[model samples]
Target: MIVPICSCYGQTEDGILSKHEKWEFVLEDTGDVLQIAIPLAAGLTTLFKKDYKGSKQFALSYATSLVVTHSLKRIIRKERPEDRNLFDAFPSGHTTSAFSGASFIQRRYGWKYGKWAYLGAAIVGVSRMEGPDGWHDIWDVLAGAAVGIGSTYLFTTPYEKQPVQVGFYSNGNDTYILSLKYEF
Candidate 1:
């Protein structure tokens, strides 16, 4: 149900790609770098912090993004923008992988890092678009971003709601301490 909405924004028929430009290859490599770096960073960070839940969340998010994105690409089996490739084109895997990493940083680490994380994410898609090979259309890139971010956002939850919460409240001269929770 939610999938359609995420994929709706950037799709189009008769899509085209841009001509090659200088220094654009760096953008493509940026996506490739993210695919390797995100998991390594998360693992090291989690180990240093001894945060078992955070590690679990990163692993789940990463795995879910790859599996879902690849599965859809195979199922849709569309073509590349220049038609050099005749399959695996509905969504961009690079874009998806990049977004997955960015979303993880944003969700777990904080938005401070999110700013850079998302810039890399967006760059991956744009780089593909700038290529002479015409690897993907804007719709493909957008759909890839949607899937990668969506899967993580859906699987990873806020840490604010703890299993047990303790708080204190004051009402005029009356002060009180309370704890409450409803887990689903």
Candidate 2:
């Protein structure tokens, strides 16, 4: 993705500096959508499935993350790359929201759901760095990822804590994989 976009934009450097696919912008937009949609989806799904506790947990996670992300944005006051603003760029809110939803799905369900969700979240973060106007640095994306993952972890710990996990997956096409995870 970066190869083609960088080549076209004349940015052959290895560092983040902007210009990628328009679809990358769409990915960020999807992150924006997920911020709202994930909580709604989780809450409603749990409610309809008669899992009241899950619904409450999901709501709590979303609210706390939203508050924390915004508060940090105000406190940090970092500047954007394109001079769009003098502050509010320490962390990418879109990335935070995307990771929040992705992490929530992973923590609540399993890696099967998490793998794809996290990929989407990562794409959202990358999209933020794909254009100058987007104006999100690598650190911004990292902080957002951390915040999103931390919030979800904090909220989901009580409900579903996986101390350790070992699993395997098969694509039914002679492709098989083994995985392991340990959570403190």
Candidate 3:
């Protein structure tokens, strides 16, 4: 049946993968899942925190990254490193998706919170290049990351409540002092 035939396509000799191939598949699959998971998590975090403005910024950044990444993929018409026949490979979409969410979290929240997400995004980029398919080159991965981060940078601002202000107070008399203020 067609289903059986299609299923067989993912297998190697004897419909089984070798140890090396298994690891590669794991990396590829992880990247594939994280690409979607990262963004979805970011959006959900915004909702959970009741950050409506951050939700809008995240949406714009994510949408822009997708649009720009896909548009360049089509316009450049670059071929994949592994697959010669497939031409939509100028930018790695997986990397873009992962970075979009990571950068959004970093910009809208803080690096302390976003560092793990960024690491995940970096793994996505590496997987795109070193995984079983090796679908993209370094340039593609870098460009994807740039597009993702750049879009977020353009639209996202630091969480409004996180600023610390240093104030200098002075009176007509010799009353001068430095005060640090933080709003919780």
The top-ranked prediction according to TM-score is 3
Per-model root-mean-square deviation over C-alphas: 12.8, 13.6, 9.1
lDDT of 2 by residue, 94-169 (tens): 8788788778777877787678778878877886787435658999999988888888888774345458999999
Candidates' TM-scores?
0.69, 0.67, 0.78
Q: Per-residue alpha-carbon lDDT of model 3 for 17-109, expressed as tens digits? A: 423445677788999999998889899989999999999999999999999999999999998884457898988899999999999988888
Spell out the clash pairs found in candidate 2.
Answer: none
Which residues of candidate 1, in runs, are more than 4 Å off?
1-21, 159-184
Kindly provide the TM-score of model 1 when superposed on the true structure, using C-alpha atoms: 0.69
Backbone clash tally for model 3?
0
Model 1 over residues 1-184: C-alpha lDDT tens digits?
5432222122223464343343454556665677567546655666687777877887888888889888998898887765565788878888888788778777877888777878878877787787435578999999988987987788676444356656667786867767576565
Poorest 10 consecutive residues by lDDT, candidate 2:
5-14
Best first by lDDT, ranked: 3, 2, 1
Off by over 4 Å in 2: 1-28, 157-184
* TM-score-superior candidate, 1 or 3: 3
Residue 65 local lDDT, model 1: 81
RMSD of 3: 9.1
